[model samples]
Target chain A: MALFLVNVLDGFVTGLLLFMLCSGLTLIFSMMGVLNFAHASFYMLGAYFAYQISLVTGFWAGLLIAPLIVGVIGALIERYGLRRVHKYGHVPELIFTFGLALLIEETVQFFWGKSQLPFSEPAALDFAAFAIAGNAFPAYKVFMIAVAMGIFLTLLYILTKTRIGMTIQAALSYPETVQNLGHNVPLVFMCVFGVGTAMAGLAGVIAGPVLGVFPGMALQLGSIVFVTIVIGGLGSLWGALVASLIIGWLQTFATAYDITAEQVLTAIGFTKPELIWDHPLQDLWTLTLPQLGPILPYLLMIIVLVLRPQGLMGNRES
Target chain B: MNKFNLMMATALAAGLAAGAAVAQEKVRIAFIDPLSGPFATTGTQGLAIYRHSVKELVNEPGALLDGQAEFEMVPFDNKISAKESLIQLQVAMDQGIRIIAQGASSGVANALTEAVAKHNRRNPDDPVIFLNHSAVDPALTNDKCQFWHFRFDANADIKMDALTDDIAANPDIKKVYVIGQDYSFGKAVAAAAQRFLKEKRPDIEIVGNELHPIGKVKDFTPYARKIVGSGADAVITGNWGGDMVGLGKAVMGAGFDKPIYTYYGATSGITAAFGEEGDGIVKLVGAGQVNPAPTPEAQEFIEAFYVSFPDLDFGQPQMANVAPMLAAAINEVGNATDIKAIAYALEGMEYDSIVTGKTVMRESDHQAIQTVTVQGQTPEAAFEYDKSGRGMVAETVVELASNDAPTTCEMKRP
Candidate 1:
């Protein structure tokens, strides 16, 4: 029972962190329909910037400053980089961002070298938050959960209850109409891109210390973030949230459980093969739940894509 | 008669000129490894070590055969892939490079070894040699071993042979968990730990064993929790890169106060992130870097390496073994072009390194049999440049003979 509860908590923590990254990506996709491929690169910048900031001003100062820096950079890229390429159509825009992502990774490697940096959690949050059945929950992980939740609520508040939020939503749905109504649609798009990237940056700032900050950090988290937002829906924020949570639960629970194919096969009235090595399906038989845990999110993503097609909370009829 | 005599004299003159050119020609060894991507850091450091060794050891007077041969490195970036390594090998050989050097991934090493052997079999006259530096998968020196592939570092099973002794002696460890990256090297480590631990300490119970996907795991908190719940007294892992870093953080974050013995826990920017949390908790088993500088020459090499490349962490001067031995072999045969003599000279060569004292090149399998240094990370100032001041102190140093760990190698030498 205790193990179950901790798994739930752990899953939620991971889920919320994924939401923080996917929310920005989904929002950007909704507004500009650009599907910013370099969105995860911005998150990577946040972690590297935070790591650099933490060296001088400590973790708190890094938390505040790094995301802001990323936001400004995101806005600049949208204005100068993405907007210039926008006239060439969506495919070119995607190719441009993909190229930009590669450029960012190389740039990071050039500056930081290819080794994992010594980015560590702050001394303050470096303790056990609590334990369930002798298994200690890290204070830093709890802190990550709290910060993710805080971002979620703050983002929710700004997007749902405010006049600016309504304008942004209108722009996402009917950009031409919004522009015809004297609203700055392009500016709104840039802001959404900036803000979305900032959220990714913020995730990086917090998650970098724990996730292991290196050039590959972006590559590691990049695909999964896409999967999260996709399984949620391209333009649906709520869909993204649901999808992230699902992936988080799937990954954590899958990793937590230990069951082998051999065990399952034996239980199903099948006798064990004496020459396991000689079996044609030896690799399949050798697989356990832990071995398959990392792939669960992708499996879930595939299932969601096939079944729902539009994603869990996605509103498009197509 | 005059015309025939002139033709014979001209042909003899041409042959003499070619022999002289062969004797004076520079020897080029291609440094093929991951010079790009995530594993580039290790490759870069390795390149630095190779450059330094060639300058300070191999090219220096009395190092090479009458200092006549010029040792040069032909750089090729394999990008950490087996296929890319083979491509690089072909490119290098096409450029007249007769020696191929690479050591990052065992998968790549295996491919290179097989490719070199096949090339040797097909060509025979223009065969290249492979000098392995750091990839330590046991099978490379076992069943998959080739006559052309010579590893300078100790293999996985040899290191495990040294490690399990300490684990057996420590009565505090009642139950141990084996966790590693989901790959050949990791599986080998797990299997080794199980076999060696059982053989050494029959009373000790193995609590858990697992293999996580290599470089895919972002967080290891859940895995750490499972380990804690399993009531494990100690942990053994063969994880490297970000996976290793994340695992270390999770272990410390949950405050799992037990030692984590590892094949690669000593590296990958781990100690820097781990501050006080890592001190004495993490252990490593490898060839060199024991505390209190094994010899004056070893200390000098360490100091000189830092002076040359200040940014890099302290690494094994494993290349010292590679360059000096190759030079010695070439010198023994008095000709760099005599491939047979050079390979034969290296078969049972006994080398004395500044770090490990003496490392033997086994005749049966080409794997180096050296003293394994078991070290642990310490916060105190115990050793020189210990992972940017977070020192990896020596715990135990054990040397084994060439026949200590038997190989499955059926070497078919040329």
Candidate 2:
């Protein structure tokens, strides 16, 4: 039971972190109808920016300032780069973002070099928040959970209870109508893209200390971010959240267990092979849940895609 | 004016001839490893180490075979892929680079070994020799061993032999959790750990064994939790690069205060990431000790290496021996162009390693047999790694007089 509780807490932390990256990506997709391939790159930039800032102003100041810098950069990219590419259609927009992602990764490597930076959590939050059955959960993870929940709530409030939020939503559905009503639709798109990237940057800031701050970090989480939104349903915020949580739990539980194919096969009335090591299916026979942990998310994504093409909460068919 | 013009043309021709002769005296080594990808950090560090080692030990004046030949390292980015490595191998061969040096991934190493062997078989006159510095898959020197391949680093089996000896001596370690990346090298480490531990400490139980995908895991909290929950006295893993750092951080973060034994828990940002948390709990099993500075010469080499590449740790101490050993073989053979003669000279060669003392290249398998040390992270380490005050200090040293395991290699000597 204690182990289960710890797994739940760990999974929750992982899920919330994923949601932080997915929320922004889902928002940008909804508004622009273009999946921002560089969304994770923005997250990486956030971490690198914060690491650099933290060197001078400390982690707290970096936490506040880094996301803003990333937001402005994202806004500019959307205005100067994506806006120009938007006319050539979705494929071009995607290619542009893909190129941007590559460029961002290279730029990061050029500056930071190719090594894991010693971006540790603050000393204040270094202690264990709580211990369950000898397993101590650090205060930093709790902080991450808090920050993610705070962003989700704030984003929910602004989108549902505010005028700008309504305008942005209206622009997404009917840009011509919104533009005719005297609102700058392009400006709205730019803001959404900026805000979305900023959120990803925020995730980077928090996740950097835990997940590590390195050049490959963006690539590490890049595909997973896409998978989360896709599993949750494209352009659906709620879907992203749901999918993120599901993946989090799925991976965590899978890793926590030690169930092997041998055990399953034995239970299913299959006898063990005489020369197991020499057997062709030895790899399959020895396969364990923990070994399969990393691929569990992709497996779930495939299952979701096969069963529900539109995603759990997404409106779009894609 | 006619006499001056004639003199100028003669001088230019003489200079061109001298340049060609100098170029002929240069020995080129193609360094094939990941230079652009997730594993680039490790590969880049490796390249830096090789470049620095060659500059200090082979290329510098009064260095090994200093006047005989100038050694140059030509880097080729393999992107850590086997196909790309083979392609790089072909490019290097085309460029007249007879010496191929690589070590990052065992899979790539296997491919290069096969390709080089095939190339040597087909083109015996222009045979290439592979100098492996760090890839530790035992199969590379065992069933898959090639005459052209010489491994400078201790293979997985030997390292595990040294590691299990340390574990056997520790009475407190009754149970161990063995984990590694899901690959050939990782599997070898796990299997070796299991085999060696069972042989050394019969009473000790392997509580858990698992393999996570290499470079794919971002968060290891769940894995750490499982390890802690397993009630293991110690943890053993063969993970390297970011995986090493991540696993170290996660295990330590999860409050598993027990020691986590690893094949590569130091250097390349791992030591820095572990920082104060790893203090005494993170133990690494490998050749070459940096903390206490194994020898005075090694200490000097370490200082010089830092001067050249201040950002990189002298991670691969075996790299210090590679160029010098190769130079010794070349000098014994009397020329760099005679690949076969150099290969024969390198076999059963004895070289005094500055870090690990006297080391031998086994005649049968070409695996380096040297002093393997199991070091622990300590703040008192003389040479701090990755700018982290804490560094690896030698806790246990195993001086092997011969290969730990009998060779399965059947060398086809030409």
Top model by DockQ, which number?
2
Here the TM-score of candidate 1's chain B is 0.91
Score chain B of candidate 2 by TM-score.
0.95
On the 0 to 100 scale, the lDDT of residue B158 in model 2 is 92
Global local distance difference test of model 2: 0.90
- B49, model 1: CA deviation in Å? 1.7
Best by TM-score: 2
Candidate 2: which pairs clash? Answer: none
Residue A145 C-alpha lDDT in model 2: 92
DockQ values of all predictions:
0.72, 0.74
- lDDT for each residue of candidate 2 in A150-198, tens digit (9 for 90 to 100): 9999998888899998998899889999999999999999999999999
| Predicted candidate 1 versus true structure: per-residue lDDT over B327-404, tens digit per residue | 888989988877767888988899887776688889899988877777888866444332557767778878653346
lDDT of 2 by residue, B1-414 (tens): 999999999999999999877864678889999988778877878888888778877787535455757888899999999999999999998988999999998888988899999999999888899999988889898899889999999898999899999899999999999999888888899999999898989999999888898888889999899888889999999998889888989999999999999999988788888889999899999887776888888888888888888877878777778888999999888888889999999999999888877899999899999989999999998788888888889899888533657989998887
TM-score of each: 0.94, 0.95
Consecutive 10-residue window with the lowest summed lDDT within model 1 chain A: A112-121
